[model samples]
Target: MSEKKGSLSINSENIFPIIKKWLYSDHDIFFRELVSNGCDAITKLKKLEMMGEAEIADDEEFKIQILANPKEKTLTFIDNGLGMTADEVDEYINQIAFSGAEAFLEQYKDKTSEDQIIGHFGLGFYSAFMVADRVTIETLSYKKDAKAVLWDCEDGMDFTMSDSDKADRGTKITLYLNDDSVEFANIFKAKEILDKYCSFMPVEIFVSDPSAEPEYQTIMEEELTDKDTVIEHIVEPAKTEEKEKEDGTKETVEVEPEKKKVKILKRPVSISDTTPLWTKHPNECTEEEYREFYHKVFLDYKEPLFWIHLNMDYPFNLKGILYFPKINTEYESIEGTIKLYNNQVFIADNIKEVIPEFLMLLKGVIDCPDLPLNVSRSALQNDGFVKKISDYITKKVADKLSGMCKTDKEEYEKYWDDISPFIKFGCLKDTKFCEKMSDYVLFKNLDDKYLTFKECLEENKDKHENTIFYTNDPVQQSQYVNMFKAEGIDAVVLKDAIDQPFISQLEQKNENVKFVRIDADLNDSFTEEISEDELKDATEKLTETFKKALNRDQLDVKVQKIKDEKVSSMITVSEESRRMQDMMKMYGMSGMDPAMFGGSGETLVLNANNALVKYILANPEGENTDIMCKQLYDLAVISHTPLNPESMTAFIERSNKILEILSEK
Candidate 1:
């Protein structure tokens, strides 16, 4: 144990052990803390020069060098940056909560990194005690006639500082590795740690070389004249044939030869890339550069479908690159792979909170210094800055998509299939994002051409009375689509599962704009001049017959008459009811409540001009009337519009039996 000196306190003895044992998981982080302290020293020197307190040295190269030796089981960190005086070291190291780095930074706030201080807390320097059994620091201050000081600490809170006859402009920390932490003294392991955690540091970091050279050369063996190399070759003799046995059988045998073996040469592996693409500016980065970075980070051979570069300063500082990977299948294999990085060091496996839920489909690097990192750099705390960064990233993505849509429609549509899910999810979950995304989102028409909501509405304004008609299931509702086509009104295909709720919310936000299903009656005019009394009368009479024909006990039905004359008897469900069913399904509720289903019943409109419905109304006992009624009702049910499947099947069977009787005649 070493003796405690001036300003040494007993409080550190109790807390320092707890910090070493529980504060961090890896003992190697001590190197990072020590290196950070070295950078802080360099920053302090630069600050003094900027403040006119010291003369600035020309051609000074600021760097931190790390040395490790496996044979000796020792590691050393040296910096040509700055040094500390005896009094400064006592105040910073001997006393807890008195941070020399923080004080230096505050005193030189006017200087930048080239002339500004770096570190804020002195606790980082003490981290060396976690891995080293004995740690020593030799430093020489920049002040004129300053004496060199040496500080030594063993496995306790006590430390000793004394005058040294060393000549240096900065500090050097030598650590004697403990038996359990011998790996830290390995050159290869130390290099890996520095590359992963300190690759993009402001100051250049140097570590021992861990690679060896391979060469091919001619062989020499005593000029081929040694006694062991005598020029005499021996040959094996031939074997004789076997003799006949007493059983009157002759046999011959041969010996097996030994196999020859070939040797293969092994190559060395290098794990670090000094330059990562994210550190470069967006303009300087080519598409190939981005792709290479993606492959390096994710190890995926396939190229990204699209990318968004994020660079923002205020409201908050944030920087990153997000990529949308191609989703070739429905297996959801490419979700939640986006990595979160702080100062180029990986912080988390998946950045769910930093990026919107919708953007989880993207895979790339998000490096934000503003993000709060725990000691291990494994998790991030949720704070105001994190939220601000998330919002900024979302905006950047939206801006990229919108810009692509405006510049090149064809290219935008090509990538839309891959990015649509992310966009839809963003709109559904984030209200602010939804408002910004509405203008750029697109819909695919029956012809497979992409159309924006505003564009579709504008083109069909005169024909549809400003109503946007769409269908959820195109295959099941082919009849409705044909009806809309015959009336010359274009309807969008809302095939995505999220479309129903998204549109419902969109309708509520906008006025005079309606999203009607294709199966909805076209004649239910959006135009003026149809009296309310006339609509009420038509609805009452039709509702009465529809109830009787469709069997109101098992099915709920309503009727409404509209203006356009294309076809008859179309079934349409209310947007509210559809939204509720979707919500119930999302929550995994198999048994739904009747009251919660909403009172919006399905409306079945009959075209008064259609010959089948006209014949049924004129002669309620007509033979073909029942068959036509059952077929129409079944069609409505299959179209996902609403009809009782059981009652419709029974009506169909009875109609079939009646047809059989007519055939017998």
Candidate 2:
């Protein structure tokens, strides 16, 4: 064969620029594309071997070796898979977007399914140009007596092919790192990219630095297995230790029974897990394996509360594990990574089109071989099939939760606090998920007991009747919580940021149900009936006194005779108005005045049964009457919510003055 040179079979002159600059926005993904192409080549060879068209040794190992040479500024991907001849390279390499895997599948369509082929677009090889100034391919076909072919292309448009003395059986792609992409040629960077995209690929992957000395690890002879390639064996001398004899005398003796031999091996670790936990059957996976995989993949040391293993084949080939990680801090955002994969090749993280927006809060991996990916595989193509996959994932999550609630109520309750945010977010985003999980939703009460919506509604039915009470901050609202407890009333805790909107969504779905904050109102159980005339008189007097002392004529003041005598005054805001304020704050409009969006609808409830109310009524014009009124207002406001800086400062000053008066006494 003679050397041949020609222009690449590209449709337009601007194609190379489009492929390098505009196609893949993320440059690091070039590693994934090239590695995945190597994997496909290996898979095609295996398929050929299985069909008896090719012969392979029983002990032969197929792997993809990534060599990063920083000094030479070149990145290489070598695969011991099906290679191509000169003619094959001319047909596949020179063509743009003509997938060799697709062509192989077409030729062997009757023998194998397309599930194992990772490359749909032959352009995956051209992705090398994304970070390379020059790309070269050296391949020796699996066919007998096939001459090795060397193909090189500079600027990704013009190419040269010639006969080569290569001895390898598979393709080797070398990328001369451009000035801007020199970082990729570093061994550490190469390993990082491999770990990110090829961690769970079907074929084993190893990264190495050719310029660096070979790394060796010593392993005990007993620990050495078939997978290891031992370089040499060394025997260690037995150690001696002082031992206590049966007669209570110390004696020097050999601790080890015999000398131990250890084997030294090079490159003992593979970068990718050929069979990830997600690819296995759920019945075959153990709790420990799930936990280990979670720690390894997500790098989250905190144990996940639970996980959902998704395995399906008929409707669409999908396999994954969704982990509900235990939230370490309440203030931390619930955002998590949902790595999307196509046949074990990672596409991106948190792809909403395939992962379902709500599932983005879960740390997991979903590999759907049937995913419709665009040329770059960075984004999902708009297709109804993708929606089916998304819906399938949501259904699986809902099924897991609802099933747990039915059969494992105790364990379900234990994980409710950690996983409730995800479930609630799902309920808000997915209608089908909400419908399935509606009955399984658990609400933790003030006593830390978990209860469903029905249980909560039933427990409060006799007293509050259809009104559901909840508290956001149990510590800040302890006063209200204790009052509710004393009155034999119950309220669930909704502390997560998502709870407010979630509860609103719940209300919208269940029109008859209502959610009110613990501090939103004074329940009827906390008060006793009083004569209408006496109540009216007390209300009028307290309103006038507070209105004058606070210097606000329009202040809403109500006097109620409460059972708890220790209670002085408390503030209450209408549920609607409080929700409005919360919405404003969530949208970053908290700085706006409440008056601008209508009044806060707040009212001061003065407990008539308390000694402070009696003293104020008896000494309306007393020397300390105005001081007592202002102090009561501040205390009520403080108990209800945090005071603004100006109000808090005034409250502290007033407190200090009162303390001074007491000291003088």
Per-model RMSD to reference: 11.3, 5.4
Candidate 2, residues 81-178, lDDT tens digits: the string is 99999989988888765545345334433432222323446567777888898999999999999999999999768889998889979999999989
**Positional deviation of residue 398's Cα in model 1 after best superposition, in angstroms:** 4.5
**Model 1 Cα lDDT, one tens digit per residue, 236-334:** 344656768789999875544333322222222223343567666789899988888888767788888878887766765667788888776456554
Candidate 2, 161: how far from true, in Å?
1.5
Clash totals for all models, in order?
A: 6, 0
Q: Local distance difference test, per candidate?
A: 0.67, 0.86
Please name the candidate that would achieve the greatest lDDT relative to the true structure.
Answer: 2
C-alpha positional error of residue 509 in candidate 1 after TM-score superposition, expressed in Å: 2.1
Q: What TM-score does each of the candidates earn?
A: 0.62, 0.90
- Report the C-alpha displacement of residue 366, candidate 2, in angstroms: 0.9
Candidate 1 stretches greater than 4 Å from native: 1-13, 17-89, 100-120, 126-156, 160-196, 202-274, 310-319, 333-399, 423-438, 476-479, 497-501, 519-553, 557-572, 597-665
